[model samples]
Target: MNKEYLIRWIKAAGIRAIKTMAQTAVATIGTTAAMSEVNWVMVASTAGLAGIMSLLTSIAGLPELKV
Candidate 1:
């Protein structure tokens, strides 16, 4: 892949990863979750895993990916 395509893919993947992380964090937090009682480590790890999965999935196919 060319530099331009690589850049575009990175941007697309990054955005997707961020979105996934946000969604995961919200879901993990839940409506009844208390801030003080929240499992911060669990939430962070779950969100991080979701983001990483999103990034890996983007490698299979993404709008910005030429191939």
Candidate 2:
């Protein structure tokens, strides 16, 4: 329940989310490159979802700070 611990956890979650987003982006790009037919809408949706998830996770993790 320490504030520092909570901050660390939040930071870790943010970092993890960012990392996941990067990984997903790379995978999608690679797949699209290999497959001539890529869905722009799907890619946009995926990126948006990933960003939302990252923000949500970061926010949720903030509660641990008890601030």
Q: Give the winner by lDDT.
A: 1
C-alpha TM-scores of all predictions: 0.85, 0.58
lDDT of 1 by residue, 1-64 (tens): 7888888888989999999999999988883286456787899999999999999998888965
Best by TM-score: 1
lDDT of each: 0.87, 0.72
For candidate 2, the lDDT comes to 0.72
lDDT of 2 by residue, 3-39 (tens): 7886788677777777777777777877887898777
lDDT of 1: 0.87
lDDT of 1 at 25: 95
lDDT of 1 at 9: 86
Clashing pairs in 2: none
Q: How many backbone collisions does model 2 have?
A: 0
